[model samples]
Target: MKKFLLVFPFLSLFFYAGAQNKNLTMQDAMLNARTTLAPENLSQIQFVYGTEQYVYAKRSGNDVTWLTGDFKNKEEKNLLTLVELNQKLKAAGRTELKAMPVVQFNQGADWILNIQGEKVAYNPAKGSFTTLIDAATAAKGNVEQSKAGYTAYLDHFNLFVANVADAKQVTQDGSSDIVYASSVHRDEFGIAKGTFWSNSGKVLAFYRMDQSMVADYPIIDWTSIPAKNVNIKYPMAGQKSHHVTVGVYNAVTGTVVYLKTGEPAEQYLTNIAWSPDDKYIYIAVLNRGQNHMKLDQYDAVSGNFVKTLFEEKDEKYVEPLVPMLFLKNDPSKFIWQSNRDGWNHLYLYDVKGKLLKQLTKGAWEVLEVKGFDQKGDNLFYVSTEESPITRNLYVLNVKAAKSRRLTSGFAVHTTQVSTSGQTVIDNYSTPEDPRTILLSEVASGHSKTLLQAKNPLADYNTKASEIFTIKSAGGDPLYCSLYKPVGYDAGKKYPVVVYWYGGSHAQLILNSWNAGAGDYWFRYMAEQGYVVFVMDTHGSDNRGKAFEQSMFRRVGDVQMQDMMTGVDYLKALPYVDADRMGLFGWSFGGFNTVDFMLNHPGVFKAAVAGGPVINWNLYEVMYTERYMDTPQENPEGFAATDLTQKIGNLKGKLLLIHGMQDPVVLQQNTVSLVKSAVDKGVQVDYMIYPGHEHNVLGKDRAHLYQKVTDYFMQNLK
Candidate 1:
């Protein structure tokens, strides 16, 4: 691939010869960046179920008015108003809504909404509402409602099913250690929720995690009087992990049966899916080693092991994130995404696990599988076929095995296909463009720009932003982004602040708004006369498996090498001050910042790391074991990346920050390093947010940024 330096043309909208001059305040940059400083968006923009018309909400005064438009209509019309919607709510004996709740049109032309925690159906024509699922019954979270009007939720740790009239407890043995109807495996393998509702809503499958064998880890709450210890079950690498099982609940008979997975009991059962007919359930069962995975089927009613459809084995690791997407028109066929062939691609399989066809194949990976058309003939998806940093929409003709790009340009696009799949809404953004939404016809590829959002920072003077690629040490292209200081001068050198998260399952640089900085902090620093830089190293996401697996058994080695390649590029620039460079990152990036400063001493003059992982052994079992294996099996690899062991070599000004309540990367990781710094007679600064979690969110986040800025200014600047 040829490399090119592409300066975003859309920057001209915000940067000009003499338009305005305004610098970002700390509060605006950190707290309100996603709100006041964020780009304008169409609220609740979606296709009305089974209709060509799409609706969006626009604020009128204190309330919003719902508006609808279609390709044929071309003119927007009012769909509903707060006053009328409230009248209906009052007539139905419900509390009148002060504001318009997020409403979705159902197949019957009625709207479905979750109002006051209850799933209700509103008939716009009749101006009435019928509660589909009662809110009082759903006292706990993890709520899931089936089409059959049955609701499932977790009360305490036990699973419960309820209808409009009554409720029933499905599990009686649930306790603090024995969890049910909740996410398992620390929410790995893309398991966001535990409840799985079948097509007809006849059966509900949920996860049962037994953590009695795991060790207890304490998270101190300093806010309490004299402080308090909250113990949580945290399974570490090379330690005994929690055992998990699947339970099937029959809504008709009110009986539960557990699947006979049969194993060492510590294996991971991920990607749970129900058959279209609700007769069988499929699970991607991965072993403790994570190198082998079996796609197994079980009878949903009896909980008997049906058969092992197929198995996938990888020398490094076999990770199955997405569940099987069964075809609606043909229940016997399904689409499975895997990286078995070195890239994440879609494979068509029959009920017997026989390969029907490979739906997609290439160097680029499919980022998401949207859904099929009303006829289930064509499939919609998002991928990086255009460029690794850009996500574009594509439509695949399943029968012909052909794909066509429905979206264009080198930008990130998130799409929503219509009910009939004849039209789609593409919401995209570039470094220059904050947001641009287009309504396009999938058949003709003709599109009309629905809205072109004005730059939120257009009135404020901003510097130039560039998105390009650089060659890594191994000659692979590393995507990079740079935000130059305001009023940049070619002859004058300026201090540089490098922000990065060089870890798996994340990408820092993209051809999107603000170069995917995600906040105004980078621009805020640039306005302070510091060049801000970010690079997506080889191990980052959206790249193929080989690119990511290059760091297998050695997490920080390849990432640091690629990051140094970016640093070298910065140092070579005439306007970058090589003598005064600093680093900042959070979580995995925090680990990288500390690792880089220690491993490559004197490279960075100052650094700040938040929630850094000092040792792999202290991290969770599922994520750490996948990348670094168990500590017993790869002690040498673990020893190489351990920052506490290399604290004595630290030469730069280092500040470690942690959220005391962070359960993800426990505060212990940073405290252990603080202890090691004392042992090594090295000076290390530290700060802790008493009530914050892995991330210091809301207004407190501004304080975190202030501390970071002050550290860089006092030490490096």
Candidate 2:
């Protein structure tokens, strides 16, 4: 703990740390954070679901161990020891799983653990101990397994289906305007878990959603006791949208079906794959001006419509996020992902759609697939081909079609693979290495570290960043980073703060590790002395698909002409103060810190903006019609990123944080920009949070970065 700050010339800087003598606090910048300054990350390497035969566990000050391995029988064991599964959950009175629970193995290696709220089923080579669901009969977010031993969850609001000795309920109309199973369009394309199973889970498929023809939106609940509106069904943007159907069920014929997926049941039937001979399923649909798409293929025990194998239109939309990958033992080819060749490559197709070749082309942008290498003849992905802010790891030989680069590390990797792909694990990071993990050997990339982590800010006052590259006004280049204010003194001008996020899937500096250093309150406002920068404009996020469709339909014109080429590299930084500069962001970096401080007025004097989107006809309709193509067809690109039609062209000192339950850019977008800055008398500075949503997260995000470091040290120090 080296802290310092003590300035005192009759000091009066209000809870100061300003001209950084050093020290830190807003609860040491949000509840004593800086704990090891971030690097201990091994969040995933488990592999027992669909087998690569892994296990992993490792703990020391009390010894935990598990281990397991087996990349094609290089074998290694241990397997059951988290203090002997907490001494068999303290001899079954349960509750001791505490830290290592996600080890889930099933096809014979018997693992399934879940502990505290119970769902046991252990086996470990016959140490036998079955309970599998019974935390007083399970219910909250229920359960959901299925490697044939079925589990499918949810009870209050029906839809069940247990296994370790029968349970089955399967929806009795849970009503409250029909839900059953959960997650729907609101969760957008990735569609987080709403069940799905098949290929041996013996039919499950889920997601029902009916939202009784939309329209509710009240949400008042100020911790109640007279404050209680709470309606929430909000479909907004041209409204009335929720219908989603997918059902199926069966669990050995308890019966259910549903997927006809036809009609205007409010379009968007998303990715949802299946077809490993579980009598077919697939879906991809989309149509609701989400510019056509039609991957279809249904009939899982008579849900019908088994046809349309290919289609993908897009005047400005057709999104279809991932779900084709089949080919693990060839159920008749698969692999699809597309940006329709503007970049996001990979096409292979089969099962009657024909195209069979296009496995990976480039401008760069594959991003993730990580599977098949166990006799499927190679294929493992993760790319930007090397820099869309970095992420590497390749392989692709699905019949000598070519592809190679298995991580020559600059960082941002992220592997796992193993089931005869011949080892992988990886887990990377890097603008200066803060997470290692190795394990390697996918055909000689060769390695073995298996865990590194330990930096969590090693003591503090952090700051050493530099990763360069600028040139944007259409000449491209971008990627920036900078840091400059940690005990610096280039004749001291200081101030500066930047931290943007120029949208389109976002990418603020990367070569992984410290490059994703994350804006820890701009590293606690560069330990409170400022000058922090971070760039990647021109529609960030893994560059490809013509660099994220270059702000199509003008979303803040190439993000303020690439943040005015980062304030002309911070007014040619001579220790950079440039009129005390400042800027930060939240939702779309609070709509680019108020659209680049009102379209570059004075190059930012002060700024904050959490949860901002000041109107694109109030956001959603599958992401503002795939990048602003609807305010009745880009009315001048939604009247130029519509910041409430440029909120009186805002000048400076702007704050406006929001989240009085922001269901995605909506606290009526800063109460309609403070009622259009009180009908243009103009003067803003707000903060809301209450029961937050769309962010201002936990520990109230350290009182939202101590009210954004006391409004940029009272308006840019």
Candidate 3:
């Protein structure tokens, strides 16, 4: 691998950077982002990316039906009857159904079944029933089914493969030091799944994490009648980290082969992609230093290294979270996504490690791939090509490398493509439109509305949010948004609360419906006559690698610089009260929230930081090292970013909140921060959620948010 440098346009030297349509701002972002109820659907739902065609269950008043054609020539098909599912569930001792049960089909929708509860299957034609597995409320490990009718799951520390008839233990070791069939690297590097089935379903590839050498941190469970101590393998920065390997299991042979993605054994193996032929596996192997990465190909059969397709290195870091996609017809040629040129785009490469061509290039990043056509002639993708704030679909000819904008309207569109690439299922919303799920025809660019979700908060009086652009310390433009009081009086200054999470890989603001997501508390606070300001600034996501890495070797510095620039702008506004400004954040935003209260003392009279990382030294290796390097490598940087050093500078009613059982940020961070504050004679307020983790969620979330609002009102007001 060779090292290289690409100067980011718009002056990498300087950078800076919200809004809500009737949507949620960071203050209330996604405060109601979750849905507790499931929508009724047909046997299955499928969408064609970049097109207005899709297959889904359509409901018309009292009539519910399924369609299997384009938007224009849609054909209704009777897949199953209510009588059939009720009969099947009744035989299985389930209560008689109300309407029709939500049934899921196989990948190809060849069969319909109830994946939940008893896992019952129905043969609509024959009116027969098949119970795949017994009713299970939940299991110790996650249970996932393969297209080939095999179920793979984790049984505590071991991995298990099973079917309706029989089961087999894939891993035998039960020691807590080792884990099989589990998400590793604290779920970073986009590694969310452990078990991956081959294309033809002959093998199972799973992650084996050995944390025997890592440190065991004790988490207290205080809710029990008698407190319980839970020990977890927590690898801190520069510490002896856990090792991971990929093991492939052949179901027919009952043989296992581990990939030889050799390393210091502590390196990160991410973005596992299987070749179309199922003969090879590709891994984006990142070194422990995190500055260098190689897209390595390995033989699935022998676990032998086939070749290093390419490598990427950067002075700050090279994060490879996406895997390569092999062409459907041409296995020898594959498409790889990279940000080497300062923007994420697509590049075509051959199996021989030759760069065939650059498919897409520009200042925009491809947000997601909606999949290719059945023939692989066209590729559909959602991108920031339209505007960084919005997501729209585009279709590209794989061979010609030419792309056409599929979506024209100004809105955020999360698209899905059909097998033939002729249909697109567009789930989009605007500030004016709460949600509009459409079926778009790829060739004609015509769309038919599938569902227009009415405003969920129509009855509630929510003040519309406004977006603004502010310049950062680096002279780059930053987007921000705020919600004013329901009945605003410009003659009077309103207390303003600035909430943000300016960390890597997460962009808080967007141009979607409901301004992407909002906080209900923000609306409540607005109704009570306060302004809520939130910004997605530099050192965060979407812009480019350089924009995010501006804080390299320093965690909370640049983020705050940009944030304060925005705050200063807000302070100048006639309606925003400068003296009553407050700040709030969670996780990375939490880390910086404390950083701001202490580093920039008096900026916020009151503040709340939940689940914060007190010091980089205490954070996990992969993430911390990527941004801050090892504590030993950058002692001064660590010293500058650590909250312990700035505790004495704290000059506000600072409230530090934490989940006692937080594995990511850990309760130790708040404990350490509080102790340092005491040692330095600094006043600090604190709270702990007995059984919560990194985030205070569920019912407790409302309580936590209310507490934050109360703290700011008591102190800032």
Candidate 4:
């Protein structure tokens, strides 16, 4: 596998006006830079499997129009060309295109394409189409069909009804923002799965988030008339959060009942699951601080809270409830993940909340719940049992409670099992290996490679990466990888850049082949004579709940200690110059850089802290309260770790950069730190990227990386 920061340092300084012997526009610079950093291959690598067909929008090369495609077939098949499809509708005498086209399957009926705006349903087998609902009526959410089908579409959310004759609206109050029947986060990123649907699809339980109460952080478009502000309802840390309410809707009666939550308005109502019989709803409610969690069962019909299934309290903090299973077809029996036993493990519980068995007992944490097999005898999941830095697939007999590792290798493996649990798609990569995607039989362990990403930088003549294990000051072994420069020589020492993000609940060192934007940037930096190293410090995630919560009350102490040990380990390497080392990070990484630079200045010559949280007081209640407790309760600890107090201790050359409109870490954090440092006569270079946010996205990121490269070359070189 290739390290991320090994490719682009020479391109970083190509922007300097004084060094500008050649004319290079921003576009030219980016195009030239991307040539050195582009991934070797661009192919559809399997990430995960879902119940629905893989539908996504793509750009057409011919006319630069948007087209939708379905990834179910082996070959890429365009569902429709927007222009041609629109022209066909215009010929059919349709004035408007309201809803997009959707695919539906039925046992007796042919495959159908339901087109919005056109209000037409096309049957592929019959070669005929019919208008199901008028465009104006469909826009008003008045469409409905009897429920016995393999798939059914109701307004925005879809469902599979057992009896089409008995089907009705499960939710009545769903709108643009006030959605009740849909999944959260739009089926993108991690939180793609929906809340819950009954075994027979009779009762549909979902989360209705009231984001109207939350403030809309605007993203402005300069091209629009008067520069229209795109208001995004973003819930920042310590700020007013969106109110979440769980609802159990009856599809037969078209009635929606909100589950009774005794807690205050801002509490998080998450991890909702319905019983097999659809009589009761299970929900996990956590306080805004996220320390106290209560799992309650409610009557689906009456909307009355029946009893608390389980209550977990953590001295440090309790994580959001991660539900493993609803016990196959038995809703009364379920599996829940908890760290109350010091390590994150699975606990089987009866409907009455009595602990039935401890399904998984270990020091390591289960990374994913792959669901149970057909027999309901075996449970498959991913875990970091072998090492904290690496992940592998595993299976356990639910009845016998006997566990066995399914994957045997040092590389990090991420697996996604099919709904049947018979087949799995396993993708893995190590520091020295390219990523390989494989299809494997879960029971037999037979596998076939689907795609192997070619090493994109093979032609770049980059040096190899070395993996090492360094023990922290606390005796915990930390896994890290070091990327040597392209022309590394044993006799000549290279300036080291320790890329750090020692935040709780984040893993930096992984043996995955999918390199992100930051990883590519890191690789480019490494190619420029900087030996880049990344370590998963003490407070980082994927170890277990205890290891993750270890930084509570004492935010920077353990992480800094572990990072110092990593620095010491780096200094021992023959190719590293200990005195010429530097650090760079963003967000929590930025926080780590600022904390380390202030507490241990002599170790790093130059440091960059981008969008760092200088004080815990500025952060939000939900996230900050979980790890650090309330600032009032831990004033001493907060003061000790606060970056503002340690700004005067700055001894290294530092550069502070921030996006002017960052909502997560807020640009105010960087501004405050710089102001404090300047007031104390501490010299620090600062840059503000106008209209940027927590991330310098799009073309702005290229410019940001260039600036960072220039900073490192000027100070560390």
Candidate 5:
């Protein structure tokens, strides 16, 4: 990928000429960008990744068919082609038919499909479908099938149990306001997985989230009649949160028991897991502020709190419950990732939350825990031990406490380890290479090429990326990447633009594939007599939790300090004009950019802050509270970090861009900043995309980038 970028000077020139249309509309700009930034089909999906079997609904020879893979092998035979299966049911006197594929049966004999909201067992051999459970009106959670043919679901906000013979609702008190079976907040943005199927699949445990008492944050959509308002029960920073509880349902007896959490409604219950024997449930509970966490166990049947297995406390804030690792061979044993030891490391723990051993200990943080091997002894994870700016795969032995580096090379590797941890699909690139995908062995490190994206911009004449390192005023090393324009000269000084995100849990300077717009925008700026630089500061991602958590309580201070140091570093460069430096960023990056311009106005001549969080007090609780704590507790910190409060000190030509309907960093943030600047008699440029959200999607992004580029050129140049 790096070589392609380096060699494609001509292609870059052609793209630049074609893309540089002054009168182009926002739609046209987006269309042009998409044409250049076409994504590749990697044959990866949510459930079935890298599988030859293509699951699709198609019409075949007068019959609608549902097929998985090539229908050559008997085991790979048709689960059910829609037309034939429906005709057979119609011939059996069942006219109304609706079948949707559910969970894949372990033995691959048949798939559990939903028909009219009821689970049914469809046999390919008999061409028949039998009703396993009766139809219900509410949404059904994933079905759990036991070896004894018992099935269960979270129907009508409560657990429902059934066997091959009959079905019954296990829980009685379930309503729209009181949900018992489904995950709250649509399971996105750090919601824990709800279903807990035992090892034998005979018992099931599920989460019940009650949001009746929580206040709703109204989301107004003008597209609907009378302007529809979606009342999202959002837990904003320092706000009342939803209460979550766990319940165990017996598949054979049709009984349910609610686990006792003892924690108040404001607390969170997450990472719930059931024991192998279905005797106990383990859960991680955190307070509203998210500074303290407790790993608790409960009796599955008796609904009694057993004991506190482990506790983690932080002076700043403890991280919320991420997904936990459970051993397949010994369900009593599990693995945990924590920053209590000052670095994110893996720890082996028993069901009682007793520390069995420390698996991996180092300064590097484990990016992900990608399942255990077949034996459940070795754990596969991605880490940045090689370089803070790069990620690579690693494997650790649970019992031996030994670890091995899986990928050792210059290119940065992001990997997806298979469920068995034997095979990995590694995607990597560097400054000198294009993105190349490889399938490699976890233990042996042998790999085969899968896909190497051709550099479509190879024919464009462009300058190459120059990598450099700078030491901050505090003597901490910061990695920076500089992009020079095509056909450069050393005689004349050029305007320098610093693109930065300088936030906790983020890294911008990386040896990886670059998007066409990003590359073109940077290259174009350089081509137009501007120097482009991106620096990854100390409080960035991939480094362990300590480095990221350094910004706690002082969100914008340390990052700005590092960025100002980078400005000094750039000012020292012979080719960069000290007076012509600009900064731009989106979201958290935008917050940094604006805050820097306001607080340290002398360092930046121009800045563009897009979709910024002007005030921490307005953000959501889960993410904001983790880093800044509750505003009630840290009032001074919140007041000091508020960009709107510091707008009076703005010195730069600032362009404030925002999406009108941005849900993450709401549009009100931009409005507040603009109002503050106006009240202080400060001049600022502003633009808003009407129907856009936090990110300008499709063609809007092109218009956005162009707008940003034009603004920087006009102001900084």
Candidate 6:
């Protein structure tokens, strides 16, 4: 590894020599960030469905006005106001809305506005509205709507289908142990929503999870009068997992058929897709070991296994998160994302699983697949080709095997392509610029700025921050960010706090606004006369597969090595106080905090770990096994990382915080560690948030941060 660090040349030095204004309060940093302190943007912004026109909400006080602009003419007008919308709804004999409902363009010029529990289709130009579905009466949990006028949802563990006039129950034998139309596998493998609607929208496929064989884990709700215990089915590592299967429901005939996914019954069915003709359903079937995956096709109507389209196997693990993206003009062809060559890129495949060619190739990962043009020849996507810290837009010509970058700038961009593929709405941000939305022509790449948000922290006396890179032990460039103390002096030493989420699927340092430190808490720490540092180690996201796979068997080993490298770098600096260093992280990061405190004893003066995973054996089956494997299979690996066994190694002041109702990383983890600490005669500080799950959100977040800040202040400051 290189001994010298390489600072990014393009990054503007945030150290302002001039006198600044007010400092950030905890409320302004934590509670009011997304509200009053947030950067302004085109609210509810998107291209009108199937049209080149785009619309966004503009709020002024109690009223919200929607503005629509044409892509060709660049003319924007007030499409409708809250009063006008309410007047139209009242005229149509529906209940009036006090505030503007979240609107989406569905059927041509009509607005599908979600008002309370009903999806109302309103046409402001025609002064008419139609109630599509009343969610309160008909649909509830995991609701999914289709263009074919069918709504599928789960009510009390049972699956139901609702039409215009009536609702039909799809499953009758659903109970607490038998769930229907719900996301299964603990939401791993990129499963966000429960139901999958076919292209024709006539068929709905959902998951049926039978966790009766699994044991129930109790979480005490302290908010209750007498502290009620809520029993949840949590499958720990090496334990008996829940059995899951897919159920296909026919809306036209009101029939249900279970997919004949003959298996060990404990496998994972992820990345579900449907044929355009709605005849076949494709699922990526992964074994419980999570090393082998088979992309299989099944007949939708018959519920019979058709064929295995393809298979992927890895020595460590093969994670398929994105579903097949079939071409719009050609249903027989699709795009698949894989990291087979050690980098996440796109590949072209026929329906028969024939590899046509690799469409994209490079070191950077393809972040998202936007969409294809009207001809399906050009594909739009977001990638880290320019830099891992920045996300930019790129358009690939499938036929020519060529690609070009559409959006420019050293910032993170999120884009929405118009249906015609002629234009794109690009939303991006940088440290100096809060946010900027651009309307760009896909063909020529000509762009026009729609909104350039004013800096929200203009009035605040924020300190200096910089995003740079330090070499890892293996010669890889690890990204790091540093926030200096307010009124920093080079002659005096200042206490330092290191923060990071050095885990899979997360990147803490970025090129966006506030350098990807979302809350003002970092600035608040800087205000308290302490330097803050964050680093995205090898295990973090957006890097290639090899960088993450390094943590396959041993989770915290590589990340700790890189983190210590960062610490060494900081100690060399004259302004950083090596003896007064501290650490902070939550969730996986919380795990890191404890790992560093124990494994590398006396390295940190103080640390705060929130919702930490104390024992890998106690963590959930899906996530823990993916990285650490089963405890029974790799007992030594689990034993090495388990913090409960190493409580005696802890040297400095450590504060452990947990949510009493945290289901993800259960409170049992902390209890187990505390029990071990007691046995070892070690003293540690602990705090708990009652009735909170996984994270302490809302107003409670400020309290949690305050507790963390106070602990660090009392110990390290």
TM-score of each: 0.97, 0.32, 0.90, 0.77, 0.79, 0.98
Tens digits of lDDT, candidate 1, 1-717 = 223354445345234424556778998788777898899999879988887777898986687998988887678999889887777777778898776888887345679887887778987668778888776765577888888889998887788998777889999989889999999999999999989988888689999999999999998878789899889999999999999999999988988899999988989999999888888999999998999999999999889999999999999999999999998689999999998888899999999999899989999999999999999999999999888878999999998889999998878898998889999989999877789999889989888888999888876767546777788777778887788888889999999999888788898877788877778888898889999888888778988998989989999999888878877889888999998999999999999999999999998999999999999999999999999999999999999988899999998899999998999999999999999999989999999998999999888999999999999999877
The Cα local distance difference test for each model comes to 0.88, 0.75, 0.77, 0.66, 0.70, 0.89
Worst 10 residues of 1 by lDDT: 1-10
The residue-by-residue lDDT of candidate 3 on 284-392, one tens digit each, is 9999898899999999999999999889999889888788998878989999888899989999999988999999999889878877887889898889987777889
Per-residue alpha-carbon lDDT of model 6 for 1-717, expressed as tens digits?
A: 345566667767684524468888999999888888898989989888778788899988888999988656767999788887777767888778778888886345677877887877876667777777885844478888888889998887788888888889999989989988888899899898779999888899999999999999998877688988889999999999999999999999988898999979999999999988899999999999999999999999999999999999999999999999998878889899999999899999999999999999999999999888888889999999999999998999987778999988888998888988998999998777789999888878788889988777777888547888888988899988889998889999999999988899999988888888878899899999999999998789999999999999899999899988998999888999899999999999999989989999999999999999999999999999999899989989999988998999999999999988898998888888899999999999999998789999999999999999999899997
lDDT per residue for candidate 2 within 74-189, as digits (tens), equals 64677776767888767866557656665566335567766666766777556667776677566557467777777877767788888778788888888767888877787777
The total of clashing pairs for model 6 equals 0
Q: Which scores better on lDDT, 5 or 6?
A: 6
Model 1 / residue 478 / CA error / Å? 0.3
Return the TM-score for candidate 5, rounded to 2 decimals. Answer: 0.79
Error of 1 at 322 (Å): 0.4
lDDT order of candidates, top first: 6, 1, 3, 2, 5, 4
Span of ten consecutive residues with least summed lDDT in model 2: 1-10
lDDT for model 4 comes to: 0.66
**In what order do the candidates fall by TM-score, top score first?**
6, 1, 3, 5, 4, 2
**Could you tell me how far off, in angstroms, the CA of residue 34 lies in candidate 5 after the best superposition?**
6.7
lDDT of 5 at 330: 78
Q: Provide the global lDDT of candidate 3 against the true structure.
A: 0.77
1-717 per-residue lDDT for model 5 (tens digits) = 011112222223222323332432334335543454433324331112333233434444455444444212334345355556668778767655554334333224555566666666666557677765656522456565566566666665666766756678877787766776666543532564566777667777777778777676665776777877666565667877678788887776667788888857677777776766778777778777677888888898788999998898887777644656778777778887787887777888987668998888777777777777767878778877776666788887877999888886655787766555667767777554456766676667777665677654454444446655667656656777777644567877888888888776567766554421233567566666788888777667766666678788878888888887777767776878888888988888998888888888778889898989899887777778778888998898889878888887988799989886677777778888889888999888999887788898875677888899889878887
Q: Which stretches of candidate 6 lie over 4 Å from their true place?
A: 15-19, 71-75, 106-109, 124-126
lDDT of 1 at 139: 55
In model 5, the worst 10-residue window by lDDT is 1-10
